[model samples]
Structures are given as structure tokens and as C-alpha cells.
Target: MVAMAKKISKTVLSRTDHLLEVRDFVSEAARQFGFSEEDVANIVLAVDEACTNIIKHAYQYAPDKEINIAIVRNNGTFEVKIKDNGKNFNPDALKRPDLQRNLTHHRRGGLGVYLMRKLMDKVEYNFEAGHSNEVSLVKYLSKKQSLIKK
Candidate 1:
């Protein structure tokens, strides 16, 4: 039998309070997709950061705005796609965070993209100004993990 891709989606208000729910939802899906405990944690954190960015940057702290999170499991890859219909910002335009300077200045924010890149195999962005913004976080199962599955 051929394996088929699986997808699940959830919509939540653009509020920090909803982050826990997003994390829980992503973690559960990642675990079911056969990720290791550590990978599951990484996925959860990445999803949380993505949602938090939408709440803070895109939605501008407007709690009533909507944030959509969708999880897709296909073959040995898992992807989380977050979408928002708010102000669009291009991730490529922002320079990478200066870790050393940030540490010296005791800065607390501005590392979401960097952290997401570190945690996931791929980070991609799609946006149409005044319409919607979407960020996809993808991770692939290790060769060992895939071999163990069969």
C-alpha cells in the first residue's frame, strides 16, 4: 500500500495566551509523525515562536486577529505552515541577529527566525502585501529514524 500524506489545521486568536495551545497542538502532531522527543520539543518551540511573531509583529498585538497553523506529514518529512492576514513583513530583509551584541546589551527579543532556522530543516516565507503571510517550518526524519520505522 502507498503511504499518503496527512494534514491537520487549527485557527487561534492572535494572542500570547494562545501560544500554549499552539505548542500543544504542534507537539502532539509532531510526536504522531514519529519525531523523537527532542525533535518534538524543537518543533513545538519553533511553532510557538512563529505564532508569537504573528501575534506581535503581523497582528501588532491585536488579539482579535486570526492565526492559522497547519501540520503536514508526508513520507519522512513533517511541516508546519503558519498563516496570518495581517501586516506582511519579509523575513529575508531582516539581518540575522547579532548574538554577541545582543548578549552584551542583554537584549531579549529578535531571534525568532534564527532560532527557527536552527531548529528546523527548512524555513520558507510566502506573502502577498495586504493579503496574507505564511511561514513554513519543515523537518525531515533522520536516516536512522526512517530505517527504524520499516
Candidate 2:
């Protein structure tokens, strides 16, 4: 059976405190979209990392700006987009940390981006229209497992 499409979107202040809300929203969206707990957890982690990155690096902990989040589900796939109006960053410019040499003394900055890429099935970034930056993450749900059975 083909699954239905669903979407949820929200904008919140770019602050560390709102990170929890971001996580909760992702978990609830996953549940509403019939994602298993394990899947939900993975999605939440990826979303959290993205959100935290925005809070720490994008807005630089400045509560003045806002971060936008959009969650979309289609054909048993989930896509989460996090956007901010901060300085633009070229996603391609990010070099993967040398795991062998940087694993021990690696700073905190690059780990989140690395983890988000590793955990999510697809990750992309966009910088356009002056200063808008958007990061998108995608996850494909397993057909064999469903959080809600109708």
C-alpha cells in the first residue's frame, strides 16, 4: 500500500534553549508519520545536531535571529529542512575531518556536521538570496516497521 504525504513546519528563535523544542517537534512528526521508535530516535538525533549547529555556529548564540524548520513525509520518506538567515556557508567547503589524525584532538565544531551527514541518508546545504542558509536531511522509512498500524 502506498503511504500518504505529511508535512510540518515551524520557526523559532535561534537560541540554545529552543533546541529541545526542535527535537520534540521532530519526534512528534516522526510518530505522526508512522515512524518506528528507533527511526524516530535517529531522526531526532540528526535534527538535533542540525539545530544545535545553527544555534552555535549560524546565529552564534544570538537570540535575535530565527531558525526555521520544516518536516515533510512522502512515499515513506522523511525530509527535514533547517534554515537560518545567518552568514552563508558552502557545504562543499567542509572537509571531512581526518578520522585517523583528528579523532583525539578534534574540536567540537566539525563533529556535528559530520555526525549529521553520517546519520541521515541524505544531507544537503543551500546558500542563496544574500544570506539565507538551508540544510536539508532525508531519511527513508522502513516498510516492514510502522509506528501506527491502521
Candidate 3:
């Protein structure tokens, strides 16, 4: 049997206020691809964290910046690509916080990349030739292995 596929794309301003809109759009895309409610919720959460980081850290909540989000479902996998015209970043190099130090300081930041890695089957960052940067998040359907296995 031929696997099914779905694709959707949108661009939204990179502002903290638009984070909820981004989540709603991601949820709708996952729903259309026939993902379970639970899986769809996870996808939305991961994407939300990613966009939140982009808007807050990368773009610094710049109202003029734009974030392009592409949602695709193909070959039994759900994927989301978030492109931003902001400073490039290598999420791979992000250091995990020392839990002890964080607890001592009572810090409430720096968990976005970690959460994205935990929630998605594939988390990748791309620094293009120009100012555009992209973060790709993928989650497989129930039959696929969990991403946490490493």
C-alpha cells in the first residue's frame, strides 16, 4: 500500500504574542494527518517550545521578524520545519544545565532545546548560507521507536 502524505506551510511574525497561534496551527496540521490526540498534543508542545525559543532568543521578540513553519506527513512520520530569519544557532552544542546548580539558583530557563530533543524522534538545526536558520522536528507514528532511546 502506498503511504499517505500531507503538507502545509505558513509564516508568522516572530513575537511572543504569536506563540499560541503557532501552536494552534501545528495542532491543526497534526490533526489533519490523522495522528492520535496524544501524539498531536506532544507535537504541538514541542513545536511551541521551539518557536518560543526562536522568538525570544533568536529574534528577541522582534515584531518585524518572520518565522516560516512547514508541516509535513509522509511515510508514516510527522515533520515540522521552522525557519527564521535571525541569528544562526547550533542547537547541537547547547549544554544541558547542571540540575544541582539550576536548583541552587532556582533558575527557570534554558530547557527548550532539551525538551525538543526529548519530545521528537528527530531534532535537527540548519544554518543556511544567509541569515536564515531552521530547526526541524520529526515524530514518528506509534509503531516507530521512541526518540529517547538515543
- After superposition, the stretches of candidate 1 with alpha carbons farther than 4 Å from their true spots are 1-5, 103-106
Per-residue alpha-carbon lDDT of candidate 3 for residues 1-150, written as tens digits (9 for 90 to 100): 544347788899988788888889888877766677888888998999888888877887778889999988775688899999887776767688677888999985668888888888999898888688989999887643222211
lDDT of 1 by residue, 8-69 (tens): 89999999999999998988888777788999999899898889888888989998989999
- Per-candidate Cα lDDT values, in order, are 0.88, 0.82, 0.82
| lDDT for each residue of candidate 2 in 23-90, tens digit (9 for 90 to 100) | 89889888777777887888899888887888777778888899999988886788999999987766
- TM-score top scorer: 1
Cα RMSD to the true fold for all candidates: 2.4, 3.2, 4.9
Q: What's the TM-score of each model vs. the native?
A: 0.90, 0.85, 0.85
Model 2's C-alpha root-mean-square deviation from the true structure amounts to 3.2
Error of 3 at 133 (Å): 0.6
Report the number of the highest-lDDT candidate: 1
Judged by whole-model lDDT over C-alpha atoms, candidate 1 comes out at 0.88
